[model samples]
Target: MTAARAWWARIPDPVVDLVVVAVAVVDVLVSLEDSSRLAQAMAALACAALLARRRFPLPVFLLTLPASLMLDIVFAPFAALFTLAERSRDRRLLVVCAVLFAVASATPWPLDDLSSHDRTWTLVYFFYTLATAAAPVLLGQLVQARRDLARRLEEIEEAREHERLLHSQAVLARERAQLAREMHDVVSHQVSLIAVQAGALQVAARDPDFKEGARTIRSLSVDTLDELRHMVTLLRASGGRATELTPQPTLADLHKLVTTSGIDAELTGELPPDVSTTAQRTIYRTVQEALTNVRKHAPGATAVVRLWHADDGDAFGVTVTNTPPARPSLPLPGSRQGLIGLRERAELLDGTFASGPTGEGGYEVTLHIPTQSG
Candidate 1:
């Protein structure tokens, strides 16, 4: 199939015409009478006219028609050979060939001093021969048309498949980015809390309450390490196996997060279970990231976190604010990723999140999430 298609790609109309004319000239020479050289010469010229079929199909037909008519009168048996060379791109050329064939076949000719009945039989034979010679060219045109249509359809399907693959890749890239942001927010908040409690423990080692502070720091560190391990395992697993990891912390876990952050949080609201879960998780992460930001970038600054539910109880909000340290400068290491991850989490749940320096020289982070029932 490949070779045939390659060959067809290189085939110009002129090449087809040349091949046809060459074949017709060979047939004319072998079948025509040698004594009538003038008639043979006319037949050869008529066949040669076919070489210009691509450029001047009508003119070639007009030139060949009279020669064919003369051949039919002079050598009736050999006249059909010229009909094969009539093939051209123009449909009008076929019409000319048909008219010439009919006229040539119907014309009378003197053949070996034959009777009128024998002459009529020879005319019928010539008509049948002309029809047979035209069949292959007509069939070739039909086949070429079908091939062209098939090629176009294949190209369209290939283009559509390529577009679909590109669209799918784009969606997967976006989802992966969102996943990375979520993981960063979750782990960084836990790590920041551990660091702050450890520092406090070191500074207050001479005091009696240092033991209690040290114990708390150790517990928070262990819990954070376990959670981090589970997240890593979940990420590595394939298929349904990943679901074995502990379920994500939701609204019910907000109190634990705030307490671990060493913050006193005030919460008020009666939220639907599903909405409460989503809102609580989003708020918890936001607060965690905000506190981490404060401890690293604004040490010695106290933090406040407030959670509220709307009157209708369909929406909830959280706000975390903290004053800057005595000397404000660049943010803490990994602080940028925390806020970015929190923003992505909020957007995924169709909520709003914002964090920036407040007018009172303090940083404030806020989140609002809508609750939806299962």
Candidate 2:
């Protein structure tokens, strides 16, 4: 049955119609002595009409049914016509074709010479032929329906797979952007600190009282390099592995972060560990970026760093504001990715971050990160 359906699907309607004509011709040849040549010719013509079944099914059925009835009297070969009608999607035409077939099969030709047994056998032959003709048409319809359903299912699966691939690519792009921002923030701040301290070391080359300052500068450089290495390692790890970002600078390191920028600053706050870590990093980077901006574009500007924590233990905030020099002219050093990185870090910990010019000849950055005790 499977193989037959497969074959039927491939066979065009015109080819199937030609096959039906061949079958009709063979039937006429077998019954030539009993049926007239003219009657056989008519049956062949009726079979030929079925070629139009796909394009004009109702007209084909109408022409073939009556012709089948007329030819049945001579050779009783109307069964093929009934089969074509059944294959048609129009069921009303199939019913009409069935009625005509029944009439043609039962009607007796040259009745004067026919006997009772001959009539009964002829009626039985007609009924059997009609049933055989209808079988394939019904089966073809079922097969076509199944093929349609399978095609639709394949399309749906392809669409779903496309959507999944798009979603994965979008996630990967977001992660890459976030990583870029983090690198910019870390590298820019550390480089700015090194530059400022290097200048201080050069100015105090022969002064013993400034030896401690030189040592601090050397220690910060080594620590900065270590942090840079850690960031690089984190970037290399893949497949959702926990990133080994450096032990993030917290409130404890805020003093060093401010002093390294050559900024005279003060800090005050009773900060929780989690909030303090997130806030400290955010503040350090913000202040570092701001002070770097000051040194590059507004040299000789003084800056103030403020740390505030609420006693209710709900929130911690840090603000860094810096004034511009009288002759501010140097272009800002580093890309603007630092503030973006700060905002992303704050958001990752469900915190808030803001930065802008204070409209008082200086820039200000504010960060607030919430904390919970374990």
- Return the top candidate by TM-score: 2
List where candidate 1 sits over 4 angstroms from the true fold. 1-20, 31-41, 72-99, 109-130, 177-374
Q: Which stretches in model 2 have alpha-carbon errors above 4 Å?
A: 1-17, 36-38, 72-96, 109-134, 184-374
lDDT of 1: 0.61
Candidate 1's residue-wise lDDT over 1-374, tens digit each? Answer: 87987898799866766677667666566657643666667676677766665465556555664556555422222223233333334556564665565566455443347677977886787677567545644664565455544644554465457559967865665564455446656775667678677767766687658866786776777677667656655543321232444355676776776676533344444345445445566776787678766655664467777776678766777788886553323332453777789888888778888888889888888887766521
Question: Whole-model Cα lDDT per candidate?
Answer: 0.61, 0.61
TM-score of each: 0.38, 0.41
**Prediction RMSDs, each to the true structure:** 25.4, 25.6
lDDT of 2 by residue, 241-357 (tens): 345543565667667776776444545454555554445667667666666555555544677777777788777767777786633243434577867887887787688888877
lDDT of 2 at 182: 66
Give the range of the ten consecutive residues with the poorest summed lDDT in model 1: 73-82
